[model samples]
Target: MERVGLYPGTFDPVTMGHLDIIGRGMKLVDRLIIGVAVSEAKRPLFLLEERIEMMKEECGKLEGPGRAKVEVLPFDTLLMHFAESVGANVIVRGLRAVSDFEYEFQMTAMNEALNREIETVFLMADVRHQAVASRLVKEIARFGGDITSFVTPTVKERLLEKYRK
Candidate 1:
């Protein structure tokens, strides 16, 4: 059977750290779905459409041989439901620190209770990207700090454009 994996996040502005998880996640599955959550509660800086477009643009560059096919889509329902909808055999998550593990651990337990058919896989963020987070990236950009290292040039440009408005 084809192995499909789901990586769900708000992806307010897709960062290099996110791309790192995606790049590595691609190696583990036949297809990878980057689910951009419609998280109104997060008060995302970028609109859902904008986030999807950004993910698509960045993910496009990841396409190559021996890699899983990538798809970027929006979701607002329960994560397991989304995973099932995409036929995901695994749900990939990126871990940056112990704090993240605490929350993810709880989430994994809950998700496991909801559906044990799909497994959750966590990938440690690259050391260089350990300090990167979308919230922090936006904070830096808002203060005119250099965010080139945290995100791609296109994403940096988009963030700056949002701040300019």
Candidate 2:
């Protein structure tokens, strides 16, 4: 059976760190569905379509026509429901800090309870992205800080445009 995984994130503005995780997760699963979740409580910097578009634009750069499979999707309801919709049994997440581990652990436990068949896998961020996060990037950018080195060139460009507007 082919393995399929769901990678869920607010994405706010999908970062290079996200791409790194997606790149690594692709190797572990036959296909990866990257879901840009819309949260009511957390108003994202970028809308769902914007987030998805940025992710697609960056992911399109990965080489080897078929080295890995990817899809940019969206979910406003439960993540497990979305994962089930696509027949995904695994959830891919990236962990950068200890706080992240705690939150992801709780989320994993909840997801497992919600769907016994689904498993959430946590992958550590690449060394370069270990410190890059959407919140941090936005924080820096909001204050007129340079974030060009934090995210992909495309992300940097989009962020600048967002702030410029």
Candidate 3:
């Protein structure tokens, strides 16, 4: 049977950090599905379609061990439900700090309750991206700060575009 993994995130804009986790996770799992959660709680820098396009453009395509495949999806309902629909048994998450860990822990527990067959796996963010976050990145760019080093060129351009608008 094929092993499918889900990487769910609020990737308002695709960041190098997010890519880092996806790249690394691709190696470990047979397939990775990058799921962008449509959230209404926090203001986003980009829409789901834009974020998916940017991620696809940046990643170029997904290759995995054996016959693994990578795909991008926009999810609006319970993530566990999405995981089930994708036939994924594991969920990959990128943890940058204790705060992230706490939040992920709760999510994992909740997901576990929701789906017994699915398991949540956490991957620590690369040190370079450990300090970069959507909130801070948005704040910096809102004031005209450079974020090219933090996110992908597409993301930087999109941020600037939003700033201008």
Best by TM-score: 1
Most lDDT-accurate candidate = 1
lDDT of 1 by residue, 1-165 (tens): 999999999997899999999999999999999999999999999999999999999999998999999999899999999999989989999999999999999999999999999999999999999989999999999999999999999999999999999
Q: Would you estimate the TM-scores of all the predictions?
A: 0.99, 0.94, 0.92
lDDT of 3 by residue, 58-165 (tens): 666546345347888888889999999989999999999998888888888899999889888888999999988888888889999889888877679888998899
Error of 3 at 70 (Å): 1.3
CA-RMSD of model 3: 1.7
Residues 83-108 of candidate 2 have per-residue lDDT tens digits of 99999989999999898998888988
Q: List the residue pairs that clash in candidate 1.
A: none
Candidate 2, pairs of clashing residues? none
Model 2 segments more than 4 A misplaced: 63-66
- Model 3: per-residue Cα lDDT at residue 15: 78
In model 1, the worst 10-residue window by lDDT is: 80-89
What are the RMSD figures for all models against the true structure?
A: 0.4, 1.3, 1.7
Report the alpha-carbon TM-score of model 3 versus the true structure: 0.92
